[model samples]
Target chain A: MDPISLAFGLILDPYVLTVMVLAGSFGLFMGAIPGLSATMATALLVPVTFFMEPVPALAAIVTATAMAIFAGDIPGALLRIPGTPASAAYTNEAHTMTMNGKAEMALGLSLTGAILGGLFGSAVLATSAPVLADIALRFSSFEYFWLACMGLTCAAFVSSGTAVKGFVSLLLGLFIATIGIDPMSGHPRFTFGNVDLMGGIQFIPAMIGMFAFAEVIRSVTATTPHFRPPQERIGNIFKGLGPVLMRYKVNLLRGSVIGTAVGALPGAGSDIAAWISYAVGKKFSKEPEKFGTGHPEGIVDAGSSNNAGLGGSWVPALVFGIPGDSITAIVIGVLYMKGMNPGPTVFLYQPELIYAVFLSFFLANLMLLPLGLTAIKSSKRLLLVPREILMPIILLFCIVGTFAINNTVFDVGVMLVLGLIAYLMEENGFPIAPAILGLVLGPLLEDSFITSMIKADGDLLAFFDRPIAAALGVVTILIWIVPLVVRLRRRGRLPEGVG
Target chain B: MKVNDAVPGAILIVFAAGVFQQTLGFPPMPGQDYGSRLFPQVIAGLMTLCGLSLIATGIANRHSEPLFVPAEWMRSPPHFVNFLLLVGLLIFYILVAGWLGFIPTAFIILTLLMTRLRGRGHLISTLAIAAVASLVMQQFFGQLLRVPLPWGIVPPVYW
Candidate 1:
């Protein structure tokens, strides 16, 4: 069958359709909550995916992440508290718009912009992934080592906080990844004689612990003041969105392009993409003075950019098997668990599955329109769900979900310990996303490095002998050195970039 | 209680040192030049450097202001007590959930947390919510998804 026909048939399966709706709703719910995130939404779905077919499993993650990114705007508009970090960029502007009784217009523009940006990103992914994968198929261990280094370097540099802290987090994750038996040496590294540690640290449980469990602790200790839901009744969310989108069409296009580009880069994700697009939008806006005071221009651009970045992230993940962001990092784990090892060969080997994954992005974005509207309309009621009830329920789910992964109480113990570790790390301003990415990529990094070393007979210069590897190695080195050079040239002054 | 960045920085440095020491004990591969310890040793070295930089940054900023900013809930005894209670409940669930079973454990934890935290006088409503949520989650995850929730004393229902 033709790829398009095959993709349609796969997506149209009753099981896939049902899973999409359920996942979409769950994503909306998670994103509408003040403390929950897109990463947490995906992490929570890992157990559910265990019961699903590969197509539906991939579909669930794709659909859920898109919905979550868009739904983040609901809390930002109503409560001035961004439901997800991606919405943090424009939360003040969205809240200001809400105060001025333009909440519907703000939400409508966000919804529309997300759809457009997502479709644009999906287009880029569909066209670029195959070509990129074909080229990436030529890569050997030498190329992969540099590629992994490039990813880790990007993780350290791209994060908004202290670069040292980001590196520390990455190192911590890499250390955790080293706990299992050595792939090449066939010796246990850090199991410390524990039987459960032999299989290494379970990724899903650690993820649930860090993202969901830590969130539960932070929410309960709850220092932030809760505002009563705004009295403004949301009328036609689509109202006046068309004129605003038309007026700021250039901003929308620029945001989508920038977001897609950023998302394709390793380590940078939708949150960073949204913040960058918003900053860029504000910089070039004709009515810059109107920003943070009910301005729709930045909102339009950032909303589009964040969702677009989601699709863009899939590019690297599907093509190179390297995650473009933390979400894709988890998606890569899911891909591996599903026995769909992502790489250029996947394009040739599983064309139908790849096309179906791409098509699901389109379908998910289309579904976002109706689902997002319903979410915005009833957002007031949604926010009213007391944390006292919701949090405990979430806690129960976390416990059950961790256990469900390996069906072991030992995994729950891992979850508890790691959850505490994550909380402490975040409390000290350490970025957790990079750590998660490091854990996902650590084994790949080790395997590639070892293979390359053996192949070269311990010659360090051999890594740079291949033209592609040389170029990649040079690029990675430049990424590390250029930032330090700039920092030194400025006499230790940090660039005024979006944190 | 929150400590200054210097404390975490110091802890990381020590931790990295310990890891580096541990890597010295890993048995080398017989034929390959790169052993199991090479990547971890590299990670430890990087961590040590980063940890030193963090320590420098923290000490440089120390004279400016107090680094510890306690949460608002910590100021109030009742709130702090409530927070501790919740933590204790989480630990309790982790310890006994397998033996007590998911449905009963979840029901008890959710009910207690809700009543103490937000339920106040709405006892009946809180109980209803706890029961319903526990049942729905049990049925969805255990039966529908085949997660094998511990049965404990409750009769297991097959769907």
Candidate 2:
């Protein structure tokens, strides 16, 4: 049930080992492509995994996801496109290094940092999951409601805009979430009795719509922003991995720690993890002013944080039946439907399988070094795919991906409608990230809160009765109020008729 | 800044009122006081409050410049209209696709959208993309996932 048994499980199966390497390589290659994404890679492969034994298939996916996440650093460093949004962490910093004629070193440092971060995360997952699961098992409905609130509050606050707008957007998400069945009473709130509405909005379609379609719509409508040609004739992929390691040692360590923390927080996800790590690293650095241009510190911190998020996300999922990121959310669904209900009982029921997945994470992180090196070396050609052709193919993928989820053209319609909504919201001052967060977390918050209240015989204070729930409530309120206090203190007075 | 924040406020106010009215159906008994509509009504009240706040903020910020995107949005109304038209097309496709089947509905929508959005001369991209999408999705979703893609009044697409 521990790391040793898990490692042995991988060794016992030659096919699983072979599959792991190939999947890792494939993930690295796909994620290295500037336009390709980890979510799509997983989505496309989920069907393939359906035919395989759950244990080995899960190992393959775990390895591939890590590789893909690490591979994202390649595109960010070489092409400045950020192969995925999580790569947005080190994007400006890493690409700036490429412009400054140090692309090879930049890629090498981040690749190394990603592996190290992944290892750190895996170590934490290996050691702490049982205890975490025990703690999670103690949670009541009240605790779950508080946790959901915390997750949403973290995501909403992390959104890159005025906090008020973020809250409003989150409110909009909660509003949309209300358009379905009420769990406690079994009374449908906003379905209006349409049979199609009976099942509520499927998460897969909504996710595909928000991330894939909305992004594509934004891409086609807006002027295609081009990156400046890299100033450096980039050399070897692993060039100068040694000195860059020694140079940003502190930054790398701090970033990995920050990444693991943020990733453990449900809904904050990978993007926030990387950004927070990079910001903290830069804040604490000896030379803070030289950050935006071409700083290895920035790349290491961001890259480490994002990669570390891989394992951190699993902690919550394995322990609490809660997903910390989008990919983890999908993984949780697959795990449950595979006949392994993930909770404290999962630890007791299937210890070896859980350990095997954890060990696979460790191996995957180690594999990232070689896979990421190949990706960095080969990323230059990806930028030359001709945008017009590439855009159409991506659009097609979005269409198929969105449609395949529900097999309903209605979902595709929803995707397009959401895309248009996303575009307008982007055009106007409103931030769309909060809307995504709201959509993802809204149902969890509503169901848990209502269930907890009902269990407590209509007492609203039940949420605060539990010590954990009370602490989370205090933290959520503090998350809102502290920022407001800081802004007012900084400005010395409220700007005009604000209050 | 010109997004008519008052509209959302009015909508929230009305929703809140509607939800609060449902609370009347519950007896004045102690445990039944809040009722099933209680939480939603509370959320609606919160939404109204926030919506009103937004209205007040929008008005205060009206004279000032838009913070994020700026005032150049009206500079390209046609582009916006194209997006709206795209949304409209999707709505029509969804409403009618069940009756017409996947291929015809998808092909029609895709071809029209490709022509309208990308311009008239890319005939090859339009046809190729439309046709290819139908075939691949049909095979993958219908054959692979076993979700049974909806067939319409028309004959089998390929069988």
Pick the lDDT winner.
1
lDDT of each: 0.88, 0.70
lDDT of 2 at A33: 63
Q: Which lDDT tens digits does candidate 1 get at residues A1-499?
A: 8877998999999889999999999999999988889999998898889888889999999999999999999989888989999899999999899888888888988899999999999999989998998899899989988988898888877876788888888888888999988878888888889999999998988899898888988877776666677677889987767888899999999999999999988889999999999999999999899999999999988999999999999998998888899899899989999999988888888899999999899999999988888888889888888888888888888888888878887888788888888888887778888888899889989998888888888888998999999999999999889888987877645554322
> Please, what are the lDDT tens digits per residue for candidate 2 over residues B29-53?
2454344465566667766776777
User: Taking the tens digit of each residue's C-alpha lDDT, what string does model 2 give over A1-499?
Assistant: 5646665765458888887888887687657766567765665455455556777778777888888887887768777778777898788888888788887777878778889988988888888898887787778878777776776676566666655566766676666666566565566665666766766676556655665566555544554455543334557756667787788888878888888888888666677888898889888988999999798888888888888888898888788766676677667656764788766788877787787788788778877777666666666664554444444445545555566655767667667766666655555556665565566556667667666766887788877887988997888779868987897787776565476
Q: Is the docking of candidate 2 incorrect, acceptable, medium or high quality?
A: acceptable
Q: List the residue pairs that clash in candidate 1.
A: none
- Say which candidate scores most in DockQ: 1
Q: How far is B136's C-alpha from truth in model 2 (Å)?
A: 3.3
